[model samples]
Structure formats: C-alpha cells, structure tokens
Target: MVDALDGRYPRNWAESWDRVGLVLGEFEHAVARVLCVVDCVPETVDQALEVGADLIVAHHPLLLKPVSSIAPDTFKGRIVHRLIRAEVALFTAHTNADVANPGVSDALAARLGLTGLRPLAPAEGAAAGGGRGAGRIGELAEPLTLAELTALAAARLPATAGGVRAAGDPGRVIRTMAVCGGAGDSFLTEAARAGVDAYLCADLRHHPAGEHLANDGPALLDAAHWATERPWLDDVAAWLRAEFPVDVVVSDLDTDPWTVHTASAHKETHP
Candidate 1:
C-alpha cells in the first residue's frame, strides 16, 4: 500500500511544511480493509473502527505540527491511543495528491464536467510536465452565467452547510474556469493571468477576494473546504481498489468544521 501510494503521490511533491505520508503503524502489516477520508478526526476514526478498517488513508494529517506527548488525556493524543489499541494504521497524502495529474483539483474539475484540462500553476523540475501542478484550468462543456455556474457547483460538489457563494456579476458569462480544492486564494494571480472566466475554491478571504475583483481577476466561487476536496476521495478510492486487493471504502462523514450556516440576522429580517 505504501509503495503504491509513494509511486502515485510521491512525498517529495508535498510542500516543505507539510507532514504527509504514513503517520502511524508498521506499514508491513496486512491491510485488507482501508477507509479514505478528508480528515482523520475522532468521528472519522470512529467510522474507521466501526467499518473494521485495517488502515486509514486520510487526506489531512493528524499530526501536522510537533507535539510533546501522546497521552490519552489530550485531544489528538486520545485518538493516537485509540488507533494504536485498535491496530489501525494511518497515512496521509496531502499536497502530493493535490499536485498529481488526476489529482484533487482534477476530481473537482471532473465534477463540473470540465474539458481540455491544464495546470493552473505548472510545476518545476521532475514533476513539472505530465499535467502535474497546483490547480487546474479547463473549459466548461458549455458556458454558463456566474450565478448558474455557482448553482451547478453547489449541486455537483459534496453538499455542505455553508453551501456555495460567488463574487462576481450574477449574469456574467463563464466559459473557461480554474479550480483548486481546499483553500486556494494563493493562486488568485495565476487564475487572473490564465484569464479564465471564473475560479472555484474554498476559504477565500474577504480582503483578498475583494482585491482580486478590484484587479478584474476571474470571478470567484467559494465552497466549503471539505466539500471542494471530497470528490478526490472517490477518485483515490477507485485507483486504490483497482491497483490493490484491499476493500477501499470512502467516508461519508462531513468534516468541514462548519456545521451550521445561516444568513445574518439583519439579512434574514431585511431581505
């Protein structure tokens, strides 16, 4: 499993601060049942235990930062103890998977039925070519108004409490678009440079988004971070099942952190 993952999503492709790859367990242990999830939190861990998963292949790492201890009393430490006791291994494929050709954004783009795909920010060195990069730019099968595209995105990507919102003219037509799963405001300039009609991502800050629009960048569609990335779990699961004898199960749990969303009180009453 580790070898296959390494070959497909090499750890070297991850960013310098990213703590990806195997986080726990002896990799040699037989893994007949595997659960793929966006986050490896207590709820997903419970799901893994309930499903009798021998290994947990998560997108987000449980330990991204240095920790002094792993005692059961602590929050993450408690999960560490639970996994250790249950003999379930944990592995993470974060930025590496994001940069893979048919990667996270590829899955996101596929959900929107995008065509003629190319990297939004092309990579450098060994992983440069072969469609490996940060985000993706592609032509929509057909053009749609910005509002229409926002609705399509909401209908296609995994449903989240926060839903989807757009930051451009509701009637603005969109043909080509760029997409990056998770927080992707960092690529605002790249999307602008590509001159796509729109860009879809998550966690778009108010200032950055407003500024991007001021510069006449691509229209923005911001969905929940977890919702944007959930499609990749399905893609990775299909690949894992095809390549290995393991039973790959994708988690249905929504771990987006934002559980409830509603219009502001003023808007609720005034509108």
Candidate 2:
C-alpha cells in the first residue's frame, strides 16, 4: 500500500511547507478496511469507527500545524489518541495530490462534465518533468447562462445546505470552466488568463470574490469546500483498493463547518 502511494504520488510533488504522507500508525500494520475522507475530523473518525475501518486515507492532514503535545486534552489530540488506541492508521496526501495528474481538481472537473481539461496553474517543478499541477480549466459541452452553470454545479457536486452560490450576471453565457477543489482565491488571475467563462470552487470570501466579479473575471460559483473535495475521496479509495489487500470506504461526514438554516414566520389573525 505504501509503495502504491509512493508510486502514484511521489514525495517530491509535496510542497516544502506541507506534511504529506503518513501522519500516524505503523506502515506494516494489517489494514482490513480503510476509510477515505477529505478532512480527518471527529465526524469522519466516528464514521471510520462505525465502518470498522483500520486505516483512514484523507486529503487534508490532521496534523498540519505544529503541536507542542498530544495529551488528549484538546480536540485534535483526542482524535490522535483515539486512532492510536483503536489501531487505526491515518494518512494524508495534501499538495502532492494536488499536483498529480488526475488529481483532486481534475476529478472535480470531470464531475462537472468538463472536457479538454488542463491545469490552471501548472506547478514550477511539474512542468520540467512533464507533470501537471493544481486547479483545472476546461470547456463545457454546451454553453449555458451563469445561473444555469451554477445550478449545474450544485446538482453535479455533492449537495449541502450551502449548495452553490454565484457571483456574476445570471444571464451571462458560460463556455469555458475553471475549477479548484478547495479555497482558490489565489488562482483568479490564472483562470482569467486561461479565458475561462466560469470558475467553480469553495471558500470564496466576500472581498476577494467581489473583487474578482467586479473586475470582469470568470463567472464564479462558490460551493462548500468539503463538498468540492469529497468527490476525490472515491478516486483515492479506488487506487488504494486496486493496489493493496485492504478495503476502502468513503466517509459521508459533512465537515464543511457551516450550518445552514432558514427561518419561518407565523400568520396574524387580524381582519
């Protein structure tokens, strides 16, 4: 399993600041059932336990930041302890997975039915060695209005309370599409240069999104960060299942950190 991971995702692809690869547990441990998730949160951990998962393959690392201690006193610390106690291995593929061919962003573009897809911003090292990078730009099968494109994205990607939000003229026609799995504010200029008519991703803040829209950039469609990355879990699981003697399960945890609700009002009985 480790060999497969290393083969498909070379360590050199990882960024200098990233903590990719295995973050917990022994490499040779017997993994019966594995769970694939975007984020290694409490809900995902519970799902792994419920499914009797022996290992978890996640996109985002649980230990991205420095930790002074792991005493189980804090939330992340407690999760680490629980995994160790249960003998569940935790592995993550962050920026490395982002740069791989058919990576998270590519998978997302495929889900949206985009074609002729290519990396939005090809990584520096990747180009020299014939490798792709994070984010993807592609063409839609048929052109649609900005609002229609937003609706299509909401329906295609996993549905959540924060299904989809757009930041362009609803009547504007959309042909080319650019996408990044998670927060993609940095790639706005790249998408514009690629001449994409629409850009879909997650975690688009007020000012940045507003600025891009006002600048006549690509029509933007913001979705739940978790929802956008969740689709790649299946791709990762499929690769692991084909290469190892382990079972892989996709976690259905909504770890977007957003709680959506609508309010209602009562009617008055006055004439």
Candidate 3:
C-alpha cells in the first residue's frame, strides 16, 4: 500500500516543510481494506475501524506539526493510540498529491465541470506534471456570472457551516478560472498572473483577499478548506479501487471545524 501511494504521489513531490508518507504501523503488513479521508482525527479513525479498514490513506498528516509525545493524554495522541491498538496503519499524501496531474485541484475543477485543464503554476518533478503544479487553470464549458459561479461552488462542494462566498461583481462574467483545493491565498498572485476570469479556492484571509481585489485581480470564490479538499477523497478512492484489489471507502463526514453558522441580522455595506 505504501509502495502504491509512494509511486503515485512520490514523497519528493512534497514541500520541504511537509511530513508525508507512513506515519504509523508496519510497512510489511497486508492491507485489504483502505479508507480515504481528508483528516485523520478521532471521528474518522472510528469510521475506519467501523468499515474494517486495515490502512488509512489520509490527505492531512496526523503528525504534521511538532509533537513531544504520543502519551494518549492529548487528542491527537489518543487517536494515534486508537489506530495502533486496532492495527490500522496511517499514511499521508499532502502537497505531493496536490501537484499531481489528477490532483486535488483536478477534482475540484471537475466539480465545476471545468475543461481544458492545466497547471496554474507548473512545477518540475515526478509527481508534479506533464504541466501539473500548485493549482489548476481551466475554462467553464459556458460562461457564468460571478453570482452563478458562487452558487455553483456552493451546490457542488460538500455542505459546510460557511458556504461559498465570492469577491467580485455579482453580474461579472467568468469564463476561465483557476482552482486550488485547500488554503490557496498563497497562490493569489499566481492566479492573478494566470489571467483567469475567476479564482475558486479556500481559506482566503481578510488582508490578502482585500489586497488582491484592490489590485484588480480575478474574481474569487472561497469555500471551506475541508469542503474544497473533500472532492479529492472520492477521486483517490476510485483510483485505489482501480489500481489495487483492496476495497476502498471514502468517508463523507464533514470534518470542517466550524459547526455552526449564524448570519448577521444587520447588513454592512462594503465598497
């Protein structure tokens, strides 16, 4: 299983700061059932066990950040302990999966029914492309207004507390667009340079988004980080099922942290 993951999304494709690949369990152990998920939290761990998954292929690394101990007192620690006790191995494919050809952004673009796909920022490497990289650049089959695009994003992406929001004129036409599956404010400038009609992505911060708009960049469609990345789970699961004999299951759990969304009664005008 590790070999399959490594071959598809080579570890070298990940960013230097990232921690990808096997996080726990023996590599030699046989993996019959696999669960593909966006996060490896306790909830998903329970789902993995319920589905009898011998291994979990997660997008976000459970131990991405620094950790002093796995004592089981902490939440992440407890999850680690739970998986280990169940003999379920954990593997992560983060940025490596992002930059692949049919990568995170590829699945996202597909949600919009985008065509003529290519990389927004092409990188040179094994997992990267025949033109794949940071984000995806493509065109809609037909043009839609900014409002229509926002509505499309909301309808297509997994429902989240914070649904799709857009920054641009509602009636503005969007033909070509760029999409990144996760926190993509980092690629704002790249999206601008790509000259797409809109940029659909997640986790756009206040300052950067405002600044990009101020500079007359493309229209923006911001969805929940998890919602944006969740589409990739289905894509990976289908691939795993096709490539291996194992039964692949995708968890449809909404793991986005924001549980409740209350709209403000008073409307504030923004120029």
Candidate 4:
C-alpha cells in the first residue's frame, strides 16, 4: 500500500520540512482495508479501529517532528498507543499530495466546478506539469455574487460549526477564483497577484484578511480546515481502490476544532 501511494505521490516531492510517507506500523503487515482522513484526530482513529481498518492513509502527519518520548501518557502518545494496540498502520502524503496533478486544490476546484484552472502559486524548480503549485486559480462557468459563492461553498464542503465566512461585499460579483485546501491565509498575496475575484481557503486570520480587503485585493472566503480538505479523501480512496484490493473508507465524522458559532446583533433595549 505504501509503495502504491509513493508511486503516485513520490516522497521526494514532499517539502523538506514535511514528515511524510509511512509514520507507523510494520512494513510487512498485509493491508486489507484502508481508512482515509484529513486529520489523524482521535475520533478518526476510533473510526478506523471500529471499521477494522488494517491501514490508515491520512493526509496530515501524526508524528511530524522528533519526540523525546512515546510513553503513552502524552496526547499524541496516546494516539500512537491506540494505533499500535489496534495493529493499524499509518501513513501521510501531505505537501506531496498537494502538488500532485489532480491534487488537493485540484479536487477542490473540481468540487466548485471551476474551469481554466492553473496554479495560484507555482513551486520553484518544479518540473513541467499541469498542476504543480501551492494553490489553484480558476474561473467559474458563470459569475455569482459573493453570497452565492459562500452558499455554494457551504453546500459543497463538509459541514462544521465554522460553516463559512466571507470578507467582501455580499453582492460582489465573483468569476475568477483561487483555492487552497487548508490554512491558505499564507496565499492571500499570491491569489491577489493571480487577479482572481475571490480567494477561497481555510483558517484566514483577522489581520491578514482585513489588510487584504483594505488593500482592495480579492474577496476572501474562509472555511473550516477539515471541511476544505475533506474533498480530497474521495480522490485518494478512488486511487487506492484502483491500485489495491483493500476496502477503502473515507471518514465522514467532522473533526474540525471549532464546535459552535453565534452571530452578533446590534443592541437595542426594547423589552
């Protein structure tokens, strides 16, 4: 299973800082079932165990850095203990998966029905490929209002308490758009430089989003991190099924951190 994924998303393509490929489990273990998820959160771990998954091909790496201990007392250590006890293997394909031809942002662009897609921020020294980039920029088939775009995003992405939030005129017409699957606030300038009308991503901070709007850049749409990345699970599952006989499952449980939201209203003492 690891070899199959490595063939598609080569470990060499991953960023220098990224800890990818197999993170746990014995290499000799025969993987008969696989679970895919954006985050290796506890809930998803339980889901993998409950469904009798022999391997987990997660997008995010559980052990990204060297740890001093794995005594089963720490939080991440607990996850390690659980997976090891359950005899489940773990693997990651983070940035490498993002840069693949039909990668994370590509899957997102497909979900939004985008056309004429191109890289929003192409990586340096990357070989000739259609989608070797940090994010994707594309055009909508028909322009829609910012509100409409927000509605479309909410309807398409996995549901979470974070829902969706936009920073621009609600009636602003949006045609060209840019998207990054997770925590894309870093790409705001790149999206603006691409001349998109809107930039859709996850985890937009207040200062950056506000400053971008103040500078008359593209409209911003911030979604839940898990919601934005979840679409790629289907693509991964499809690829896995084509290469291996494992029964693939994509976790539907919402693992986004934010759990609730409340809209503010103007104060008026009437009662």
Candidate 5:
C-alpha cells in the first residue's frame, strides 16, 4: 500500500500548504476490508460499518487542517472519534493523486474516451520522473457534437439529481477536450490556453461559467462534484487490494450533499 501511494502520489507532488497522505492510523496495522470514498463523511462511515471496512482510502482529506481537539462536540471531532472507535484507518491523496499518471484527471479523461492527453496545468515540484498536472487536456477519439458529448458524460458518470449541465452551441463539434475531477473553475484560463474544444469538470459557478461561455470559450460540461471524483476510488481500492492483503469496499453512501426531493404535486404532474 505504501509503495502504491509513493509510486502514484509522490510526496513532492503535494502542495506545501496541503495536508495529504495518511491522516489516521499506522501503515503496519492490519487493514482488511478497506472502503474507498470521495469524502469521509458520516454517511460513508455508516456504509463502511455496514461493509465492516477496516480502512477508508479517500481522495479528499478528512482532516486537512489541524484541530485543537477531538472532543466529539465538533463534526470533524465526531468523525475522528468514530473512526478511532471502529478501528478504521483513513488515508487521502488529494493534489498528489491529481498529478499522478493514472491520477484523478486521467481517470476522468478515460471515462470521456479522450486521447492524446497531456496536462492542462502541470503541478510544480513533481518528482524527477514524468508526471502531469492536476487537470488534463486531450482529444476525443473522433469529433462529437457538444450535445452528444454532454450525453456521453451523463451516461458515464454516476446519475444524480443535478444531472449533467452544459454550456455552448449544442451542435458545435468538439474534438479537443480537457477534464478535471472536481471544482475546476480556477483552471478555465489554463484550459483555454490548451486550446481544448471543451472542458469537463464539476463545481463551476454561475458567474464564471457564464463569463467563460459568453467569451466563446471551450464548451463546458459540469457534473456533480462527488460523481466527478468517485472514479478515483476504484483505482485507490484496487491498489490497496493488490499490494496489501486487505478487503477493499467502495462506499455506496451517495454523499453528494444534494438531496433530491420532488414535491407530490410536481411528481404527480410530471408523472
């Protein structure tokens, strides 16, 4: 497990300001039945309990910043306490996973069937070896209409109430594409510089997306943030299962934070 983490997410790839890698528990601890999740929330913890998971390998850190206490009064404290009581270890890859070869962005790109991929913005302080950046730019196998690509994304990613929202000319043929697993609004200019025909990611706000689309920028496909990052969970689980003699379980907690509740009248009308 250590070797896999080191190979994929080198320590140097993590930003100095970020806290990643193993957050809870020791490496030597016997971890059988691991849980893979995007975030280590209470719902995911309950799923881990249901599956009897000993460890949870997540993309985002549960405790990124230092905490003064674990008194169970605070939400984070309660999570920490719960994991400790359950003997469940927690590990996060974060930006380090983003820069890995088959990292978060690569996995997302593959889902989109993109080819000839390269980094949209290469991360700084990457080890001497070749590693891409947080986001990747690539091209589709063949040009697809913007509407078609949007359909493909919706089909590929996990279904959510948010569905898949797109901006730009629906009929515009998109060949070159860029993708980031989560919250890629900051990379708009970088994707623009890469000259991609479209950008697929999550957590794009109204103002930013509107401004970019108004400028005739790359077509945008915004997905649920959790769905975008969930692809990495499989890779993480597989790596842990292969290297360590452990059972890995992908959390099915649907912890996307957006609850879908249709009013009875609305449902009746729609039905």
Candidate 6:
C-alpha cells in the first residue's frame, strides 16, 4: 500500500516543510480494508474503526511536528491510542498528492467542469511528461456572473457551516478560474498574473482578499477548506480499489471545524 501511494505521489514531490508518507502503523502488517479521508481527526478515526478499516489513507498527516509524547491524555494522543488499540495503520499523502497530475486543485476544477486546465503556479523541476503543479487555472464552458459562480460553487462543494463567500460585483462575469483545494491566499498574485476572471479556493483571509479585489485582481470565492478538498477523496479511493485488492471506503462525514452557522434574522418578521 505504501509503495502504491508513493509511486503515484512520491514523497520527493512534497514541499520541504511537509511531513508526508507514513504517520503510524507498520508497513509489514497485513491489510484488507482501507479508508480514505480528508482529515485524520478523532471522529474519522472512530469511523474507520466502526467500518473495520485496517489501514487509513488520509490526505492530512496525523503528526506534522515532533511530538514529545503519545500519552492518551492529549487530544492527538487519544487518536494515537485508539488507532494503536485497533491495530489500524495511518498514512498521509498531503502536498505530495497535491502536486500529482490529477491533483487536489485538479479535482476542484473538474467538479466545476473547467476545461483547458493548467497549473496556476507550476512547481520547479516538476516531473517529466507534464503532470505537476501548485494550483490549477482553467476556463468554464460558459461565462457566468459572480453570483452564479457562487451558487455553482455552493452546489458543487460539500455542504458546510462555512458556505461559499464571494468578493466582487454579483453581476461581474466569470469565465477563466483558478482553483486550489486548501488555503490558497498565497496564490492571489499568481491568479492575477494568469489573467483569470475569478479564483475559487479556501481559507481566504479578510485583508488579503480585500486588497486583491481593491487592486482589480480576479473575483474571489472562499469556500470551506474541507469542502474544497473532499472531492479528491473519490479519486484516491478509486485508485486504491484498482491498485489493491483491499476494499476502499471514502468517508463522507463533515469534519470542518465550524459546525453551527447563523445568519442575520429577517427584520420585518421579527419587528
């Protein structure tokens, strides 16, 4: 299983600061069922156990830093204990997976039916045969207003407490779009240079988004981080099913941190 994932998304492709590949469990252990998920939180760990998954192929690494201990008292510690008790292995495919051919952003673009797709910021010395990048930029089949694009994004992405938010005129036309599956504030300038009509991504901070719009950059669509990345799970699961005999399952549970949402109450009715 490790070899299969590394072959497709080599750890060498990951960024310097990223901790990809194996997180927990042993490669020598036998495996039958595998679960794919966007995050490796306590809830998802329980879900994997409930489903009888022996190996979990998570997109996010369980441990990014050098932890001092795995004592069960800690939050992440509890997750470690639970997985260890059940003898379930955890592996991550983070940024390495993002840099792959049909990457995280590629999946996002595909969901929106974007065509003529290419990397928004191509990686340095990316593998031969043209299949690596930081984010994706593409064109919609037909132009739509920013309002229409917001509606489309909400429809396409998984429902979340943080529904899609847009910056720009509701009536502004959107054709070419740049998409990144996770926090993409760093790509605003790249998207602008690409001359895309809009950029759809997650975790957009107020000041950066505001400044970009103020500078006449592309229209912005900030989606929930989890929602934007969830689509890639399908592709990952499909690949596992084809490459290995293990039964692969994709967890559909919402794991985004924000759970409750409240909008301004209708004034006329309240009054």
lDDT by residue (18-119, candidate 6, tens digit) is 899988888898989999999999889989999999999888888888899989999889999999999999999898888788988888899999998888
Model 4 lDDT, full chain set: 0.89
Better of 1 and 2 by lDDT: 1
Candidate 2 segments exceeding 4 Å error: 126-131, 263-271
lDDT of 2: 0.86
Q: Tell me the spans in candidate 4 whose CA falls farther than 4 Å from its real position.
A: 126-130, 267-271
Per-residue error for 5 in candidate 3, Å, reads 0.8
User: Which has the greatest lDDT?
Assistant: 1
Q: Please, what is the whole-model Cα lDDT of each candidate in the order they appear?
A: 0.94, 0.86, 0.92, 0.89, 0.83, 0.90
Runs in model 6 with CA error above 4 Å?
126-129, 266-271
- lDDT of candidate 4 over 175-245, digit per residue (tens): 99999999898899998888899999998999999999999999999999988889999999998899888
Candidate 5 minimal-lDDT segment of 10 residues:
262-271
After superposing candidate 1 on the true structure, give the runs of residues whose Cα lies further than 4 Å from its correct spot: 265-271
Evaluation by TM-score, superior candidate among 3 and 4:
3
Task: For each of the candidates, give the backbone clash count.
Answer: 0, 0, 0, 0, 2, 0
Model 3 / residue 144 / CA error / Å: 0.4
Model 2 lDDT per residue over 3-82, tens place: 67767777788888888888888989888899999999888888988999988888998888898998888989999999
lDDT, residue 197, candidate 1: 97
Winner by TM-score between candidate 6 and candidate 2: 6
Residue 87 displacement (Å), model 2: 0.5
Error of 1 at 130 (Å): 1.2
Cα RMSD, model 1 = 1.9
Summarize candidate 1's per-residue lDDT along 143-170 as a digit string, tens digits: 9999999999999988989999999999
Pairs with backbone N, CA or C atoms under 3 Å apart (clashes), candidate 3: none
- C-alpha positional error of residue 189 in candidate 5 after TM-score superposition, expressed in Å: 0.5
